[model samples]
Target: MIHSKRSDRNNISPQAGLLIWAIIFLVLATAVLNMPGYPSGLKPATFLKLPLEVPLTGLALLVLSGLAARLLAFFSTLAIGTVLFLRLADIGVQSAFQRRFNPYLDAKMIADGWNVLSGSIGTLTAASLIIATIAVFILVLLLLFTAQVRLADAKPPITGNLRLVFGSLAGVGLIFFTASQFDGMRQYASLQTPSYLTARLTLISKSMDDMRHFDQDLAARAEKTTDEYLFRGVAGRDIILIFIESYGRSAVEDSRYAPLIQPRLASVGDALTAKGFSAASGWTRSPTMGGLSWLAHGTFLSGLWVDNQARYDRLMISDWPSLNSMFRDSGWRTAAVMPAITMAWPEAEYYGYDQIFAAADLGYKGKTFNWVTMPDQYTLSAFDRLVRHPAAEADKPVMAEIALISSHAPWTPVPRLIDWLDVGNGEIFDRQAESGDPPGVVWADDQRIRRQYIQTIDYSLHTVGDYVAKFGDDAVFVVLGDHQPAPLVTGPDASRDVPIHIISRDRNLVRRFEAEGFSPGMIPAEDAANPPMDSMRGKLIRIFSQAQ
Candidate 1:
């Protein structure tokens, strides 16, 4: 009788341990199910879940309660944790890019971002994050190896049978409940895990399909290309296209910065008016956001919606007829003044520019403002000396794309506009560069960040206005933003719309874009139906290339 009693006690003990482990696992699984970043609103309550797998996992543990079960439990925990972490990362990447993260497509961008990681995350913070991540991973590994998993320990036959029966009941109840509320539960994930794995697989397949279709379309466009030039109307006029960095519509339209920014904008308008230059402003939806200025540049120039890096690479390699190519073909000297491009740009040849002025090529010996290679005032000064002045002396018509990047992220130590004549070699503004607050100090608070952003933008506008006041007599200038500021600056729900302005001495030049919905005098009118950035290439070509 004592032997039977002891046997019963042993059976109950193991069963009790198994039940406790099952409850803990269910709670953990439920927490994961109710986790954030599940398509914005599909996360269900923890208690409302039908976790059939929770009991099943317990049953498996109880059945295999040896070293093997312990290893299995450890690996399972590791795998689930890794997946949840990846889901969170995917959501972050999506917030930046409007699409889901594709490892194949985004891996290169990630590597490229590492080059500027210091400007992004401070060195100490990055090191700490790396160390913390490694420590957590090692800790998880050690715990899994050492954790006592006694769920599968041998028990009485009745105890084992009871576990199986209980698991069976849970599984059956889960199915019945799910079926009864099948329609309502459609939005809820059964296991509480997100569909990130399935979405990733789908993204891979879709990427392949898109590449094939893009190649076919590019080939068709290549075959249809002609050498006919239609730029006779503005043939001998100098045209300048300046892409301002991170100058989105939110700066001018959103309430946060609009009030602070509008007065400066109006001041610029007044300055331009004082210089006898008429200006029109409007909005264009950019293809990419935050950091991909090149994508917006490619889209604007090529008249193609170059949204992703893969598409941009393909567009660069293809013999695409762009604004520069058309201008070059029509007896105009085409050049690109890219102060941000510090390295070799073989793509300049593909874009059909006769000359390319990169960061090193621009004669500026000033201190770098973090990522901004040269100040806008210096860039304009160099452009005037190298391109505009020379072209004017030689009586050569010029078409150039100037990428002005002084207002880029980490907007620190912004150069104050000195006298235009004193901007020679860009050395006179060295004092101003040293005077402004450091990016680290400026970015410590949100209010300071916004203040610096506003100041930098005002500097860019004043620089442009100064350029026009000095050089507006001989050219038509199209100045616009490359893309919106990062989400941290613009908030999460910011639009991709960027402000574009056209300043010219010729009323006809400004009037041509009126039909296209551009408002007169610097501030773009509120137009809900503004065209995309890609459409500007065709519109400009149509308006300027007409028979006069």
Candidate 2:
């Protein structure tokens, strides 16, 4: 099997030509099938059973495309993508650590957080090594591939590196294509286009204004209604709004999951029933699902309908009075204890808080080297020790912001207990997995996640309730969801609605909600639905003001 022409050996023969073509075909078929695209917005069933038979019709595309002067751009862009994707994972892990530690930047707390973070150095180091290897390998191949090609010598146009050239062309074409999505999104862009962005922002602003007015009016009514709640009135009540991460109405309504949450809430509802607290529920807007806590928080506090980098930048340039400002004006001392917000949340200062306790401000002494700001339980613990304690200026009523981080996703390493750990809190992680749930396959797959999430919410409710109970008849606890959970937990078409619950162990206060049409477990009817990004204070103050 050795006879071959020496001159012809330099060129690829028919057999080699056929083999390369086959290899290229398979690579395109397999790799291209997985390419991300527009996501049709259609269900799997609809795709499979569409009116016509269209296999491989509308789902192939590459993400993060770009244009370059050289032919090596495909491999270069792919290499960049892989690096960025790994970094995103690292970011997520850091977020989880932030959540787990819920560290207040007090020296002691920072020390504790450092200890926990140090434990994850090994993982970070490994990830760095892998990324470095990928970069080096890609760079070497790039140099070789470019060197082998003769850019100047062109006889037969088809004989060159057609794959790299075509891929580059496709990337350039796509960049221009996606930018057009912004054309219709702008105001007064085109007669044929819908200015959806401006319209949504307008509606959001109206909702924010309504809520501010309602809070002021309610505080006035609260002063007149009762003697028990008057340090000055409901304004004097220390508000502890708890936002359970990724919690959905389905978590409590679905029979499959209801058992996990109903018992605890039923008890909570009963306790609040004896007190004068009423509850209601509805929706809010959010940019992302499975993550992105700031989207919900920013939309609620800023009134500017900010869900992306563009809108967020626009808000920073403006000065707006948030709910914090409203409370500050009423003479209640306000403080924001948010660990989730990493960068300087400028709105906090502009809104006029007496004290702003970011993640660093809280004196946390624990370890964390993950994605979130702090575990929900730890967030509650920080609240108990920091804001709920009696202060030297006893007469100054406090309005505190306590954002809960429980039930957030992708629900890993969930906390099982709500014990307050002053020093060794970093050890709190998930329980050992039980491998014997053969019958519970689907349920175990998703339920393990949902179950832990529900448990976290339960712990948050109990802890917050305990703290409020300690505040006695002198305080009013306003605990409401910032927004509904993402669609992954709530279903693809889930509404933005979130439930609001207020509590106080005062009977006269209990009569207030009864006079109005609300109970401890009450949810607002769908008919009363205030659309996306509606002010929660607006919804709450109105009913209580009318009751007074």
Candidate 3:
């Protein structure tokens, strides 16, 4: 009875309840302070005020009704963690519980991320997390025991509320730390927010914008300019539109960067000239840089600039026709070959392709380094196999959209000849080449990455050029850069422009593009006064549809 009375009296003290929290603050501060570099730009006041910050801030917020209870925080942590996990799982290879998450990874559905400071957490990361969590629990307990801390308030809430508060706080701390480290959480995640966030944002859209922006334009363009794209009795030739990862005209124009490579592409371009094939180039606006390759690819494919996770989700739910599905309606064999995607993506099914080939469908012939899949050459090779569909309806044309990834990040193990392509140990990612080397002669900057990317494009274009020459008017090819490289090439912006090139043996295809006020050049439709990426889909489709 005496001991029970003493324990009850002890519970009244803030020093007893808060002893662990105080220790946690010190431990966290120490760990963060000891990071590789010194913390700059932080004021001494910020450092000094931290000890009192947590509780004092709580009190201040409470006075202002801004203080959120620990229970709410705990749930927020779990909700956000689940959101992050789901996002990764949606694009993951291994199962959600076992696999890691990568946010800034250059390739699609990558098992990990690529930033020097951030990356996906795999088994090693998970084990570390479990250990750290235990350590935090122990440390907090030790501090409480040592300090005999208790709450500052004299009158206390029920004991059940106390447990909820502590439990929630622990959960909140764990998630807060994780979110700080995970790239996806920082930039692309919003799971903690209410579900109505989407409805609220979309509801803000003005009704002035109508579906006619998409439908009427098609109807009008078809009525007036449809004749040229149609060749005699041909409905629509099988369109094999490809986006060679980072292919761009700048790779050719910048001689000092790729003196040897630029000429090879120019030579390849010139050779096509005499073969009655002409190449015209233009630009599209890429929404992001360094990463988010999918957003650009999504914009081109869906004919909508899908800039965020929300936009990406809404489209997936829609029954609207993608370019591939549109071709499917024409009785064309529609397929998408994505070598970068290691696992199946739900978005692929939504887009409506007759057959979808993922990385599993691909033959991973050991090409790697700086983390990537086979070269674009292999993708083209795969396409060639698909092209000779021996059993399918021979009369029906095919529409194949292929994405080439060899030109992607950590450009290394880049083969001089496509046949010799092997990612191998990625020695190139580590090598330091002289800055002045031509495009073919790899350099050390973004251009080095670009050189590799552009060469892949050159090779793919040349390959397409060769394919056309061999096929002899049986097919049509559309090739362009899905998006610009990154901040290294084009700085981060909503409006950074990307180059778009349309190459074909068909003169009418080129004519159709020009009649819409877009001629050969790396340019977006954005004029001194024109619409932005918002208008790209309707235009490209209206032009390409005519070939039907």
Per-residue lDDT of 293 in model 1: 84
CA lDDT, every model vs. true structure: 0.74, 0.46, 0.49
Best by lDDT: 1
The number of clashing residue pairs in each candidate reads 1, 35, 27
> Could you tell me how far off, in angstroms, the CA of residue 360 lies in candidate 1 after the best superposition?
1.2
Across 129-239, the per-residue lDDT of candidate 1 in tens digits comes to: 667766865654444333225444536764466477657856775776567575654433255333545666688789878887887777777522233547665768899
Alpha carbon lDDT at 452, candidate 3 = 57
TM-score of each: 0.83, 0.58, 0.55
Candidate 3: segments with Cα more than 4 A from true spot: 1-236, 246-265, 362-371, 388-393, 418-474, 488-495, 521-534, 545-548
- What is the Cα-based TM-score of model 2? 0.58
Over all chains combined, what TM-score does candidate 1 have? 0.83
